[model samples]
Target: MTTTPEGTPTTARHRAPGAEDALPVPAAAGSVAEWTERYAHAVMDTFGPPQRVLVRGEGVYVWDADGTRYLDLLGGIAVNSLGHAHPTLTAAVSAQLGTLGHVSNFFASPAQIALAERLVALADAPEGSRVFLANSGTEANEAALKLTRRHSGGARPRVLALEGAFHGRSLGALSLTHKAAYREPFEPLPGGVEFLPFGDTDALRAAFAEGGDLVAALFVEPIQGEAGVRSLPPGYLALARELTTAHGALLVLDEVQTGMGRTGRWFAHQHPHLGGGVRPDVVTVAKGLGGGFPVGGLIAYGPDVAALLGRGQHGTTFGGNPVASAAALATVGVVERDGLLAHVTALGERLRERLRSTGNPLVREVRGEGLLIAVELTVPVAARVAADALAAGIIVNPCTPTTLRLAPPYVLTDEQAQPFVDLVAALRADLAAEETP
Candidate 1:
């Protein structure tokens, strides 16, 4: 059984007494079976069946209900940058909560202001950059979308979004997301949005060139995180910047999944491949920003655009709560103080090389920047491979049927990378043998 900070035995809400103490128990339908039963009774089925009852986590590892430990490579979808329960983050949150947990927008907290200032500085845009804090990635996009409209004078409300983009599931942000399945269910989304093929500069230029003043903004992900970690070709961001500027449309970069040192840079759009010279008018960030705490923000550069949204434009009660801001401050401090960007760059290169050198026939390609990587297999069995990896005491994810994505914690150790590669190689061989009949 795991113990909390107070040393009290922590039991799963549904697990019976002594069930939490079971360690290294045989892998059976019974272990996860009990969890599935308890989970169904306790929680909403939003995420479907509980894959595993995660009981405890430390650093880059987590233990299941049966006390089997697995190396966590997904890092809670790239949110746990300092890894699970890092003392730095926990202390920051604890101290801030004790001081002041939350305050209304009528008042401002130092932590909130400090975090905003830090983000503006890190973004390195021109002077007078303003930040609007929010509670999630989708909210960040919503804020940005609203800001764009405010700049558009309401006459031009249309937005140009990239195909295969996954902004968020929220109704407003859903309008900008291109996936039909995610959008169809919530039909009649805030209208006046067009989708363009990702990385196609000509398509973007043509759209804006012909649309003239109708498009309010060009919403793009520097690196499409949900579309199997796809990255843009060199100079695509620069082209977008030029075209958006020429057409009087704001360029809003959605760095929700690729920001906060995930791509070895503070933002993936800052990569040299995107010319590294272009500046976005608005940038939305989340995911790794708060290091697991829920925090998001939309940063608008220059006063003309930054001041578009006045006092009554948009607001949220939990948006800039002190606890979340403090967590974000601590996360940003640790990343900068520890030089984690450099660490991520080096470690990510090593991971990519190791995966590429495995000589596994199933692997068609391995590509990514920094820790956000995807291993694409020739076959569409990534879901099975992810399951197999979990069963083998490692945790990974398949963003698509043939693409295995890895976004391990920035604190992942060199020693931990090889075991995962070896495990995947074994999985590849087993799958190949099964197919060879």
Candidate 2:
């Protein structure tokens, strides 16, 4: 361990390796093919086959077992805020663990307290807003679900969520999540959850008007991540706020994929079109919050809403662990120090514009804001496009059969991002040819 000029302890071992770490060729057992084969037997088949077996990374590029480097546009599904092996994130986690790592919920650490304060400040939350830390986006939504029910003060309280929302996979969160394939097998989930058409002002008004009295809360994603980066229609969030408030139902914004500067703002709900005229009663965040360190949080605004959960009502064993808190704090600090929000805003526009400019026949449309983007293909060949991009040393996500999503690291430069656009444009014919009749 060594100290940098600013006195933060730096673990030199965590730094990206030099030529010494590279192998002439991947070891037989360590190769992607070999590891992938073994993974089938050892690991569950939840996320399907592994895409690639990555060995090491630096900045926005990661090297695979075969020493092939790739520009990671997905950023671990929008979780890597500072990109791979960020010095600040590594230093903060290493320093905090060296000082004080894990502590039970019975105790409190400075890192935990500081992170809570930082999140509250970033949200520009109400004066008495409170924070509840969890380990993942699903866990955060689980906490929020419980809080809403606890405050419902009735035997049965109905909760509403958007049709295209992806809250999490846990049973509680799954109940709020709206996907037939992901939800059908997990039937008999927590009850009283209903789905409403996303971004439909008329439907929102109708739902509330019909059953406002039975509703306890409404959960929505400012920008639908899993649904191919579908953003709420203009003025829709404001409408949601108006209806939820009028019906006395709490409005919850799920920022798991859009928060932490992924959308050029601290929270996507904070965008001018959404945050200016409306205020969410609760906000659930994770993903980039810890910059790949694994942390989630729920911010409840207003005194009444904050007071809903009493001490024994809800808790987590490892929720505000010191190491995770330190990582999140460092991630946010670096985002501000580097002015990444503005960078994302500018770079996002350039990337979107370039993708649209290609004017390729296979391209349908480009959507989303900031670094979170989605390119809809005229044919249902997005999966093929992603596979092609991967073979070409670029990593993008096929969020749907026809939608290719891009949530690159904020640290991704103009040079790095431009190649992705070019690669995708070149892959148009290859992608179209892969389409099944």
Candidate 3:
């Protein structure tokens, strides 16, 4: 048994045989229609109608309530780094939970401390680097925003983000987001944030020049996942770093969707040809960190930035949780031990090569690094293609009217990727015929 933060004793979850059998089953759990109906009444409608009621997953495939298996090309929007039911991740999470699942900020756990150390080392952060764990991508960005404010005690007020960037939906993270629809709804947001044109070097330089000393920080997604896997222009990140350093502003890289080996590197920013060889003062990441177990973090590069937050200025009850930390540690371990990063690099290259070889007119371009790919279409038929893909036992995301984003699991095998590649080869041909007559 374990106790709540308030010391209320509670029964600990078990992994013993038949333990899952004790789980309470929803009356509508057996069917997609029934579950969707129940979800409509009980859950928030934030994501719109249910696409399919996914029941379980394994390796790179997921099953719906109707027992239909799908080749999950999106990997739960890039969160499932290790794919589903990974034994290492499951064992780590299970063991940690059975021992110590959570605790208040007042206390500490071995898992939390070890995970922080690992992140700092992986980042190649200089001495005095520190890590702040959060529960989600938005929370990680929020913490980073606060850290920047503490830089020079709010003297620098201007913050920079790029157009077409999607940081998160939280008010603080949303302020850095570029989509008008996602931002305008919340009229009153924290101020001093400006959205720059994506990869416009002149605009970036102008922002630094205009903002001058008031530039507190600039947040960038090394590869803008929500903007159809758009990668920054070559040297863009290095230039941002130079300017931010010269202007005395923080250069923050948001790696939420591209970190945890999603791009065949530990972090997307490490990819020199694409993400640039720049070094950021602070880095925020989440998505694939916990391999779908909900964990995020902010890494302060050195002592000066690390000391900005100080103590009592920030706190979270569930951040740095033992189970989450364990999950992350396990995810990283498997990626290393299984040499999945190399697999990701080679497999992504193969898939892109195959797609580009098709010479399909609808395949306007294929961009992005490693497994995070985008097939930009010549027409606004991405939604139609995605629907077709769903019907064909594959799962993908139409990130835009003409962009299909694929961020498959790092463990995706060549055999598993062939179906999606074949679908792309023929999809546009079929659509082309439709528009012809």
Candidate 4:
């Protein structure tokens, strides 16, 4: 037994060669209450209290500090593309870190270059398309924001975003987000950002109709995740594309939560119902890009757009690092090698159909493409239902007051997903029984 400098007793599981007191872990590591108290003291209270002190995870199952297991349906809010501790992702990240982990922005690594090329090819980007690597969805949006600013040689200063849009939390990205609660606190954001009604083709046309040349970019999410996984209506995206092209304003699709096969397509915008035949000038991607690893980037399509942000204009220290790139590459490799795209499509449709087949009055509708789904409730009991679902050992997200969002891992089995369907049906039965009384 040894004591940390702060006097917490610890026992070393393994001491590395020539390392002094390394990994002198606290003996009472499994006590959830103790860990939660420590977390309140040590971590910022940004996201309120911790839900559960999860310790270990494998596949779609995670165990809390109390040894209770949970079926992860949220997939870390759609980041765990291949689920937890995937062998391929682990091997790739470990191999890369052991080889060449990081370098300054002035230098480039083989893994970074390879991943960029792979993304460009997978996106079907034309000749001279380029990618600006970043560390998260926010950073990727920041890069895209800068690209929009550099458009029209600064003559067009106005940018358009959508209602219920969640671009990111940073100052620049914050300007484009729609929720007033998120924006009011961070007021005096970057100017000239106007939020239009979501998926309203007429509103989009009217915005472009007035001072169309003043608009530099039109930002949108093919499927709005934080806004309850709402997809754009038919012809809405096509109308956005036509207007932006006619007015010379760049169409920026924020695919942070909807890209990298989350919607069964390589990107959500490629789906016919969402954004078919729409060629966006800028595309931002993150979330599932590196499975559970933190990595994100923006793709600038065509040589004209790619040529914008040249030397000394933008850069990052950890972005495009070899280790993160290797993780993402391995994620893509696994998705391709295992044909998870088709799997996700079929599984997602089956799950949605199963929910609908339950004929539960509590369930208003089931929507979204691929594994990214939402079960809309007829009543505003999403939070209560989500808590109940958690108690039943399945994890889900109350994305909105009336919607339960389910962005489970693509590796989730049909059997693993049945519990949620059963939960909905039981809730309906409970409601009926109460009404009879």
lDDT of 1 by residue, 1-437 (tens): 12356432232223323545768744333565687787899899889997898866777788887878889999999888877877678778878887899888889999999999999998987898899999999999999888888888888978899998988888989999988988998898998888999888889778977766798998999888788999988988888888888888899999999999998899998888854678999999998999989999999998888998998989999998999999999999888877889989998998899988888888999999999999999888888889888888888889998999999888887777777889767654457456544
Q: In model 1, which range of ten residues has the least summed lDDT?
A: 7-16
Colliding residue pairs in candidate 3: none
Model 2: which residue pairs collide? none
Q: TM-scores for all candidates?
A: 0.91, 0.93, 0.93, 0.92
lDDT of 1: 0.85
lDDT of 1 at 320: 84
Point out the worst 10-residue segment of candidate 4 by lDDT: 7-16
After the best TM-score superposition of candidate 2, give how far the Cα of residue 162 lies from its true spot, in angstroms.
1.1
Q: How close is candidate 1 to the true structure, as a TM-score?
A: 0.91
Clash count, candidate 3: 0
Estimate the TM-score for candidate 3.
0.93
Q: Give the Å shift of residue 394 in candidate 3.
A: 0.4
Q: After superposition, how far is residue 136 of candidate 4 from its true place, in Å?
A: 0.7
lDDT measured at residue 329 in model 2 versus the true structure, 0 to 100:
94
Off by over 4 Å in 2: 1-29, 429-433
lDDT, residue 169, model 2: 96
Rank ordering of all candidates by TM-score, starting from the highest: 3, 2, 4, 1
Q: Model-by-model lDDT, in order?
A: 0.85, 0.86, 0.87, 0.87
Off by over 4 Å in 3: 1-21, 24-29, 428-437
The RMSD of every model to the true structure, in order and in angstroms, is: 6.1, 4.6, 6.7, 7.1
Best by TM-score: 3
